[model samples]
Target: MLKSSLNIKVDRRDAKLVMAHFYVAFIALLVGGLAGLLQVLVRSGKFELPAGIGYYQILTVHGVVLGLVLTTFFIMGFQLAAVSKTAGTFTNKQRTIGWIGFWIMTIGTVAAAVMILLNEASVLYTFYAPLQAHFVFYLGLTLVVVGSWAVGTTIILKYAEWRRANPGQPSPLLTFMALVNTMMWTVATIGVAATVLIQLLPWSLGLVETVNVGVSRTLFWYFGHPLVYFWLLPAYMAWYVMIPKIIGGKIFSDSLARMSFILFLLFSIPVGFHHQLLEPGIDPAWKFLQVVLTFLVVIPSLMTAFSLFATFESYGRSQGATGLFGWLKKLPWKDARFTVPFIGMLAFIPAGAGGIVNASHQMNQVVHNTVWVTGHFHLTVATAVVLTFFGVSFWLVPHLTGRKLTKKMNKLALIQGYLWAIGMTFMSGAMHAAGLLGAPRRSSFSEYGGAAQAAEWIPYQIAQAVGGSILFIAIILMLYIFVNLAFFAPKGEEEFPVGEAANQTEKAPMVFENWKLWLGITVLLILFAYTIPFIDLIKNAPPGAQGYKLW
Candidate 1:
């Protein structure tokens, strides 16, 4: 069985390396969560910063650590473990390369964190040029990105070697998805690499007198929107490949899952222009093109939803559940792993709908730069992505450490997931409502006692603060669960929930495995989508703007 294959023992070196990434990632969550709690309270007019600990400063910490640091490290660690376990042992050389990458990223993270803590780099995580951070901050982030490339390179090389060794056999599901995710990341990071190395770092260091703000933003969005997918695809991997088997069901269609990943790779990058729809000088035609592509990207998610529900129905029928909706009850709600991702997926339904609103040019004008955008992404990256990470860690940490997660602890983790969902309902719901009343995002305070329009935002801000408090408590509970699983549980091995289609004979087509072809299509789409817009941005660009230390 696939589950037994997943339990195959890995060398301690690879396990330790993966665990190291998890440790740093969790520490980021802790620090970032604390900052989040402070941000909400301050915005509510309920708390004031101690002098020198500024809001933007803490916001930068929250974004960089939670968004960039935690995601990068955790994905690298998760993919490495996936490839190794699913394919075979990582050669000693591969482990060395991975460790080298990990250390470089760690050094970069430390450098950036120190700069932020010292209040020298308060430009915020978007690091929109024109508002510059210390040169080292850019350099450190560049290194973090480069380090990820190193780790991604390891995955690619290992997959190639795997293909050669296995000859005609299909790559294992987890390994296949991990490799695809790596390829997509490598493709996406090119935009950011060009932005940082060519533009921001030079501007920050004063090597360039100015950098074109429009061009810089164009480059950033090229990477930025796809970065959302980078955060998401791993969680999607869990939903598609792992969840069904965990809950005693089979993957509805392996080929459908493979197609979705391929679709994402092809459509995800080209569509990032949707983020820039409201920005000036860019052609409306180009924005419309991206809008169309954005809608195309939604198809795969619909496929996934259908596939998952079919899996549930099939399982429920087997369990003697009668009619419509009965299947939902038959799901493994008692299992923390299943319950956590299930809730995360449910959150994505509305989150995806909000994204559609943002992508539509006319609708976007209504909520652009408002707190509604903040509300949308919280349901996505914060709840869907972060909660999924927490769920995977419940088993992953124990699996890596060769320990058991106690049943009581499992119950607590499930509770933690519910708490997160409840908190997000309060926070994101209020943000959406207030944003409709014209509340802005990225502002330290929205409540101005004299402005009645601003006064409309006060109650919502307070609700956000309360919700954030609950979220903080949930994060603490997650950390406690993770630590206990890692260090205190009894020695045992955990099985991976690797599902198969109900129809055993339904093999994926050969095209699904054609990486070179898919990679080619991915490149072509990027060129088609970005080349003209980027050219326009650079050619008509107003004289580049000088850096302002605007924190």
Candidate 2:
């Protein structure tokens, strides 16, 4: 199904372009991490900043940089590497287009970061309507998104070119995964594009007097949940295509792998309304429909878990391991590249469980707008996705730089992953506990002058602050690892791992490659799920809400 070697090499020009993307992503991680620490400190009532530095301003920076900027840049860089490694060399035209996309996104990030830092756009990453930002902020973010579209377009074009040249052959699994994600992202961004370009930008620029908050939120979530899948699929790509080879095993099932990726394309988009289960204006019937769709999306994740463990178990048995859990001990525990993603998988167990909780209609009411939701996403995006990115960076940076990954740097990376997992346990666990006691999320300060309900949250807040400090330290270590490898390590070429299917003669079913069918189904689901609800939102909307500069 997949070949172990594709005669791929990371050429100098491609390496530089990919590194450009990663460099920007790391800078975001550093700045965003600092802001996260500040948030924890201030919200815990354990520290105060200068009068001019507001908490919400810092929070906005944290969310936007980490959530939007870091993920986009990292995923772009990763996909480029994946496609380049698996498919073939990129043409000069494709490389040029990629760089153009990178610059556009960087410029937009700078513009938006400037606005957030100046406190002109403290609306947070969601940037829900009626809490309007400056027109520049909206325009800047729109460019960021549009820029990603350009990147995705280039990748798809590359894939299309490959398919044309090599008719009837299965695409490399890594390339296939990249193409699927690019397609998913192209669809996902439609809603956000509408939110920013049609609605928010016009409203913020005063081209419109007011905007409907309900409609804006719905549009945002339309992009938002699928945005989560966008973050996750790259990690899954690494898991399915890279992790098995890293741990001395082959992919468990090429057919199952393709099936999961296809399912994501089919089910990931229409389920955004599950995020709006607690919001108003959308009918309950529509919300229920989304909830069901959201659960349907879970099928791929469960399949993924099964395929991965099967790969590990096969490897473990090959090494003479006995009994059920004994295979875990036989697996690589010291390798940074493998352990980081493995930890991410472990974290996902809890995170996915919490997601199930969030999607439940009755359960959502209990935790809506609370720190519980915040904790759940942290375990997911921050821990599972971000940590996996960090893990991959261990070898990726060194590989592209023509440097050897030193033993010391590998150890540092493993330690960083451990620290992150430990700190999150304290932070996220406390957050979930406090949320059940009625603690709010997104509040700069929850003290409420010692109100009894707020008093109950103090200890958990303090735990969060402590956990945050440790996590910040972990980020610092991660930065050191990347910088040292990129600049200071001994020169050596490292191979990009591309695993073969366990049975090399077996091919993925042709249906998995029929992308047009999958995409059409995706669009139909989105329309069926959202079309009437969106019309109702706009037609029955209350008086439009005016912008408020709350900070």
Best candidate according to lDDT:
2
Best-matching candidate per TM-score: 2
User: TM-score, each model?
Assistant: 0.97, 0.97
lDDT of each: 0.86, 0.89
Model 1 residue runs over 4 Å out of place are: 1-7, 446-449, 544-551
lDDT of 1 by residue, 120-149 (tens): 899887888777889898889989988898
Deviation (Å) of 30 in candidate 1: 0.5
| Structure candidate 2, residue pairs in collision | none
Looking at model 1, how many pairs of residues clash?
Answer: 0
